[model samples]
Target: MADMSALTEAEAANRLMRLAKLIAHHNARYHAEDAPEISDAEYDALVRENSALEAAFPHLVRADSPNRQVGASVETSPLAKVAHEKRMMSLDNAFDDAEVEEFVARVRRYLALPADAPVAMTAEDKIDGLSLSIRYENRVLKQAATRGDGQVGEDVTANVRHIADIPQSLRDDAPDLFEVRGEVYMAKADFVALNARLMVAGQALAESKNEAFDPETVRQFANPRNAAAGSLRQKDAAVTASRPLRFLAHGWGAHSALPADTQMGVMQAIGRWGFPLSEHLRRFENAAELLAHYRGIEALRADMPYDIDGVVYKVDRLDWQERLGFVAKAPRWAIAHKFPAERAQTDLVAIDIQVGRTGKLTPVGRLTPVTVGGVVVSNVTLHNADEIARLGVRPGDRVVVQRAGDVIPQVVENLTREEPRNAFVFPDHCPACGSEAVREEGEVDVRCTGGLICPAQRFERLRHFVSRGALDIEGLGEKTIQEFLDLGWIDEPADIFRLSQHRDELVGRKGWQEKSVDGLLESIRAKTSPDAARLLFGLGIRHVGAVTARDLLKRHTTLPALRALAEDIIALRAATEPLPDEPPHRFQARIDKAIADHIGVENVGAAVGHALADFFHEPHNVQAWEDLLNEVSPPDYKVDVRESAVSGQTIVFTGKLETMSRDEAKAQAEALGAKAAGSVSAKTDLIVAGPGAGSKLKKAAELGIRVIDEAEWAEIVRGG
Candidate 1:
């Protein structure tokens, strides 16, 4: 660790700020989606560093600090509907046996119980699957939901009914109102079979086309947990049923009455109620027994039918749990003991630069295939140019690769050899389109300037166009787009609208069914009058995300008007190039003035302004715009479209928004031309306070900010 004593105040403040951003990103990925990019252990380390930095620089704590946040609002899920009666909180973790002992001691200290007191705990395998809560009323399944942001969850009643392990009905003796919480998983054996089946299907299509199948085109799961998550979340119940999934009950949620006073008793009762219970739930007398059981589970984790990352130890006595309560997002009465990260040694054969849709170039290290944690990893990301310099990694070097706490494989260290070798040279141009690659000031990543022309950029852009946040065309996922590109049937976003013209050609193709093709055509047809903001976002404009697009379109309502403004910009630029109207220097000065006047949106500044102007001036981009405009007649949106309390007001939402998601709330605000600022300041006009309002709430009170409760906020939006 860096010497904390040696660091300057400014340096400490900067580190704390960086840590806040890093931790918040990982927290959202882990808590909200259950699809964490980094391992749980790695995430914990980041949090630790953030805490240490904050301890040193207490005054530098950000309003959006990681400590203040919980799981992100689950409102993004289409299935989200039912509000959880009791918050489905997560468990705190213990890194080692010493921490486990410390946890027990802390619990005793909190309760003021003596060391000699009989303290029993229940230790069970921590299944690495999505957490699900099934509500039972009158001994019948009422609803099933995923733990989305702990407050509200996605309703998956229809999908859960298909899982064999999830009981449809409970015994008559069960509580009148009860909620059973468990992990929904796919067995290792079934996961292998499913992947095998997918491989066969993929191969059959390739053979018919007389070409080799690319694994990239296949929507295979990265791990068993991911497979289970993706399977259970399918829009079609039949699709979920076809996939192998199982559920193992380990806990309870929102129960009307307890059958027993201990954790083991509840598990036994849940098993009797017809839901399959976890086999590893056992009562232990003290911390020694707890650690033994944990170690035993860690040893047998590889042989288990399903994936498990750790063991959970909860206070056996029901009264202790009530007394212990919660700390932050986790329960104080329980702690999860996770396995250490896994590592493997591999040879770095080659490093290739991949250009993403946004033009950011990522270095992918191709390695001699090696297995780490039973998964074969052939490639690892060196992250960027900075990572390359940090590690001094070169091709043909021996590297220590690990997936211990990361979803993506990473090369952590380079084992340099004694043999003489030249230093590696990074590329100066895009490998795909040969465009000049340049890194912006203060940015680590280098990007290609080639927009629509780069092959990689074209493929990714089209994929993003059909994504849920964009056009949201159903049945047109990445794999289908890849197949179309391979067959030379579609190349651009405009070509997507022209798909129906190839109905005859698509018929009887290897993987295309008449029903699927017709479904895709129907989806495309439905998007003819796509939302202006969504269409703009779908265009893959540089520096224009969904929110920025909405904000820009709110200012300049229609594509035609936006195009007109761009034309004026082009005219100004043209005037500088020996035009008859004015002197060159005077024309250049006019162009600068025109750009500054036209770009007046709240958050958009010079950088965004220039990106939009340059994008519109490009010939190919203009042609594509014209073609797409003809294909899908996007509607014109008024700047102050929604006449509501939120319109024309700078709003800041603090704490948990129970009514709608953060995304939904922000979208509603922007729909009315109100800018949603991240932090509250003197400029903030309104603050919507929800439950658990902390620093932001205190700040609002100090400033005498106009504050509205969630109920009041909901009522206003309802009227609009």
Candidate 2:
């Protein structure tokens, strides 16, 4: 990590922006998708680095900081979503004993306890499984949900009914309205047996079809935690019933009445009510005793039936917990002391390049099958070309791999970098489509420039087109997209609208009934008049995210207008190049300013303009765009501006919002016809400040702008 103190404000801001995006991506993978690209240690390191930078440069914190987020959103899940009565927050992590000590000392300092005063804490194994919340009413189970983005979760009531470890009814003494929060896990033996069974089933099915079986094509769970999550999250309760799963209660969410004043007391009560509690759960009066217990649990981790990555320590007194409250997404009175990642040596047999949906080439190191943290590791992510160069890993080299948190396997070190052999070479052309693969300026990733032609990119692009944020075609999931792509039924976004032509054929296919076929076609047809901004975003254009698409559409009003502007920008750039005697930087700046002026949209700068221009410059892209437009007619983009005091005003919101997310606050401002700016300036009309309001607040005061609390802002909104 770079020295936080040494970084300039601009540098810190840039790093924070990158860190925020990186963390959000990883959070979505781990929380929502049941897949993680990086190990827990790597992810934690990114968070810690972000925290260090934020601490040093508090004023430069981005709105999308990882510190402000908990779990990822479940907007894309097929299951129905339910809002949690109380938020399901994550725990802060402590990697070393010193950090753990600091946590205890911080708690003591917050409560203003004397040095000798004991602070009782409960320590329990941090199970590496899916987080679940089971709600009960009148001692009967009502609903079960998987924590999704803290505030909301996917309803899994039917699935949980099949897990024997989870009781349908609590004891008569239990609270009538209680939400039991815990981890749903699969035992190590069951995980192994499950994988074996999946493999056998795949082989048997292939043989029955008189085809060769490819293990790579078979869906196997990455680890026990993933197996447990994938099993429990099944849409079919029958599938969940077939899996051997268990649950252990760790805490309670909303409750009608408290059964105990201390955390341990409530956990004991939960245990007596038929929910299993961790056997290693213990209460300690001081930091020393808690650390000792953590170490003891770490020692027994290998022998445990289920996977546990760390030990969670929480203040035992419920009153103290309430007093400590929460900072961002974690409680101030608790921390998870994590164990070191498990490591093993393996041979790097080969390096394989996989192209992602966005056309970035990722390198995967094929390793000689080895065991790490009780799981067989056949491959490890090399991340990209830069990582491969840094590790100096090539075929026939020994390497060290680790599975941190028993999730993703990563190559940490190369044991034979000094060996006299040829270094692995990164491809300069897309392996899938033979298109030129080049790294962009200031970027480490080598991406394919194939656009809509590459097979890999095409499949991913089609999948993204039907994603939750895009057209949201109900029955068109990744698997279904791949199946259609394989059968040559769909090739581009426009082709999806024409899928009804194959209705009869689709009905005859295995797993496709007449009702399902009709439903899928209906879902696709429903998007014929989709949201203009969503359709633009669904095109998977480079540098055009959902927000950017909305901003551009808001300015241009229609897709055709946006395309015309893009073409105009292209013409303008071609007509205005560096003069013969002019400096390159000066000429570049002039053209950039011209493009920005032409677009005339806040946050839509020269990068987006150039991306738009470059996209339209390609004849193939223009053809694709026209084809898509022919299939659908999106209405002109318009913001529903309500007449209000803030209408036609520029508003800047700073600090932490307690009741809503930053995006929600910004959307509310937009709804009120206010332009929500990130930074305060002289032209700002109002400043909605929350707790932790820092430099922006000072700036607003210096500019003599009207400032109000979140409650006041809410009143203005309500009145409007």
Expressed as tens digits, the lDDT of each residue in 406-452 for candidate 1 is 26567778898544677667788999999999987435679898877
Per-residue lDDT of 137-166 in model 2, one digit per residue for the tens? Answer: 999999999999999999999999999989
Question: Which regions of candidate 2 fall more than 4 Å away from where they truly are?
Answer: 2-28, 49-69, 72-80, 101-120, 162-164, 189-222, 235-242, 284-289, 317-320, 474-524, 547-623, 636-720
Q: Best by lDDT, which number?
A: 2
Q: Which pairs clash in model 2?
A: none
- Please provide TM-scores, in order, for all candidate models, with all chains considered together: 0.61, 0.77
Highest-TM-score candidate? 2
> Whole-model lDDT, candidate 2?
0.87
As a whole number from 0 to 100, the lDDT of residue 269 in candidate 2 is: 94
Q: Report the alpha-carbon TM-score of model 2 versus the true structure.
A: 0.77
Minimum summed lDDT over a 10-residue window in model 1 is located at: 602-611
Compared with the true structure, all predictions reach lDDT values of 0.78, 0.87
Residue 129 miss distance in model 2 (angstroms): 1.4
